[model samples]
Target: MTTLEDVLALVAIDSVSTNESALAKYVYEHLIVNSDLEVERIGDNVIARSVGLHSFRVLVAGHLDTVPGDVTASVIEGDVLHGLGACDMKGSLAGMIDLALDKTPRPVEVTWVFYAREEISRSQSGLLEIAELRPDLLVADVAVLAEPTGGRVEAGCQGTLRIKITLGGARAHTARPFTGRNAIHRLGDLLSFVALYQPREVQLEGVTYVEQLQAVSVEGGVAPNVVPDVASCVLNHRVAPDRTLDQAVQWLRDFLGELLDEQDVVEVKDWAPSASPELMNPHLTRLVEISGETPQAKVGWTDVATFREFGIPATNFGAGDPLRAHRSDEYVTTDEVNRFASVLGEWLRSTPNTSGTSI
Candidate 1:
């Protein structure tokens, strides 16, 4: 059976994005063992539900995959459980599984989703797949993503955009650099623009969000001996909810227009638009009150946006620091896990009907 110890044991195995079969199997059996919930299996995605005719249902979700690579035990150190999947969501998964085990006979139905392939591209997200196949299954009064929020409710998420700015110039021998237009030298102006660009801070639904723009990568030069003819830079933008993906892309096009060729280099590499904090809902607010913590807007992108895309309200609340996730010293406090489990368990047990009433 999957106990708290079992959860820690699951974390010990490297289930990084590609190898989630073991972890998925573990969850599949764990859910089956505790309740007579209807179960469905697809790839490494596991869905188990307690049937009910309640006016509303609740969905609990956590990703089963982590980033690639493994962290040795020496790196984990003491109680920190330093490993790849320790914080990003394995701990959350453990908490949710524990929640599932402590089932109730209440009228409110509960759904547990343990999905795969969250670290890679969104198109490949396991949640997206379920969103298509069983939209109704995901339909709920509220959704909670146990995505390492340090036990506080985190609403919404920032959008992300990656674009390449290409600079063109003439090539010549380095010894006679003046003979060539320095493409790399042209990038200096763009770099300065990036260095001085101040991201905007926008407020929405009582939450403040910060936008960020940065030059994440640069590539150029055929050789040190030759003045490069082509140079390109990668820009990463964390946009606020005020803008759409289209607007964000257009903004970048305008920002890099001076350095980029109008004809040869206008294309989007990858863009994930942001989501707004939907905490205006009374039920969501009550959840915050019950947790006894002020909610914050998540600065990073997460599957909360996916649930939002379905028009379902979602929040991030889990037991560890997101900063610790994916780091060599990744770990979650056992106290946090116990507290998270208790808080979530109590909330699940006490969430009154939010249909026509003010919860």
Candidate 2:
């Protein structure tokens, strides 16, 4: 089948966040039947590897699950495939499958990973599942995460720090709100501070990563006629590679020091650390050279960070526009998928200098 056909076929299968069993089974069967590589299935994750005893190994990976969406409504118009996961990932998954099935000899050994649960929390990541269950499968000199970069080398990813801040107040009648502190009223100043935040840009390996802060959710209400005693707001901060999660949290505390009261409570809800741009690595530098476009920092979080935790220098490179991911109108073009496949296939076939001077 053609690459576009493969993308449509995969999109037709519903693999939303926690519902990836059928798609995982399909991928497992396809790899087992079409490829001579060693295939393994851990939960919903499928891994295929070519153990050619080469000095260098390259790992290509893409998540199997997408955020919840209607799959039956997916369609193709002209040369574009429109669907929920078409752009965010299915397009690149198709390319990875084709490359995995290719019998052509390459200078480096290859490992292809199609994992589930990437669209959800980091703790439930299928990549992390593989890392914990079978770290040996992830051993590689260099890695590439197929994360909808519009066929460019999106180097490194921004870390995410989610925290919930609760303000203390006293319950009182709505008419006598002046008798008690209005917890909800405290949100205005904090939100205004977040709204006026200036994104900090940090340069790493010639790539500029911009940081962001936003208030995603707020909670604090007892009843329509009563003043609430507690109010909480969830703040999400996108951090650069220069800061660790601890440092980012500390920075947030410092930023809000003046606005927070002594009784206010700050709690970390979730966090995922960032990865630095590994363009200095010869394999990644070669990938940047082959794409014929300057590398850009990935502003959002991706499994590339997870790969970095495994000591694998990885970058995001794939089909489709990342800006369109998770949207109802997401799409992937035939040219985008073809270009991704060509560049990645060529990278696999050619040998890097390993002198770390390619960039």
Candidate 3:
């Protein structure tokens, strides 16, 4: 089947985050039946590798699971396939599957990884599962995370930090609210600060990384007549590669310092580190050359950071628009999928210049 067909088929199967058993099984069986590579399945993650003795090994990885959406609502109009996961990743997955099934000989060895739980928290990442259970399977000179980038090289992903801030207040009678502080009312100042936040832009290796801050969730209520005594809100900060997790957290604290009282509590709920743009790396540089498109910074977080943690220099390159990911109107075109397949196929078949290699 064509890559477009594969994408439609994959989208038809329900593989939402934390529930990717069926899709994982389909990918595993397809690879086993159609490819000559060694395939392995660990829980919902699937890894397929070519055992050819080569000077370099390249890993092409994509998440098998997508965010919660209507799985059975996939539609194909002309060359475009519209549905959940169509843009965020399934389009690229189809290209990866095509490459995996191809019998063409390439100079560099290849490893195809279709992992699970990428849409959720980083702690439950299927890539981490493979790294813990079978590290050998992921060993590669370089990696390409097939995150939706419209077939261009989206170099380096931003770090993500989720912080929860809780404010304390005293309960008071509804009629006599002036007697006590209202924590819910206190949240207004914080939300206003977040709404007026200006994104910071940092440049590295000619790519600009923009940092963003926004309030994602808020909870604070008691009863219709009772005044709440406590309120909390979760803030999601997209940090640049220039700062560490601690530094980013401190920056957030400083940003909200004046608004946060001594009694207020600020806690780091979750965080994932950022990855620097590795355009200097020969393999990635060659990929950019092959695509003939200028590489841009990956504004959102991706598994490239996870691969970076493993000491593998990775970049994002895939089919579909990054902006359309996770939206109900997400889509992928035949041209986008085909172009991704062509560029990646050529990159794998050709040898990159290893003269001035620097990770």
Local distance difference test, each candidate: 0.79, 0.91, 0.91
Looking at candidate 3, what is the lDDT of residue 45?
A: 97
Measured against the true structure, the TM-scores of the candidates, in listed sequence, are 0.91, 0.96, 0.95
| Candidate with the greatest lDDT versus the true structure | 3
Tens-place lDDT per residue, model 1, 1-359, is 22346456768766778678888888888788864588777788899888767777789899989887563462334445555677787777888887787756655678889998999989989888888887766777788889998888888899888888778888999999988988888888778878988778888887888888988999888787999888888888998878998888888777766666653364568888677787877656767877888888888898888888887788888888888877776777666677677777777877565654532
- Predictions ranked by lDDT, top down? 3, 2, 1
- Higher lDDT: candidate 1 or 2? 2
> What is residue 14's positional error in candidate 3, in angstroms?
2.1
Model 3 vs. true fold: TM: 0.95
Instruction: Please say which candidate is ahead in TM-score: 1 or 3.
Output: 3
TM-score of 1: 0.91
Give RMSD (Å) of candidate 2 vs. truth.
Answer: 1.8
**Residue 38 miss distance in model 3 (angstroms):** 1.2
- Residues 92-206 of candidate 3 have per-residue lDDT tens digits of 9998998999998898899999999999878898999999999999999999999999889999999999999999888888898988889898998889988999999998998
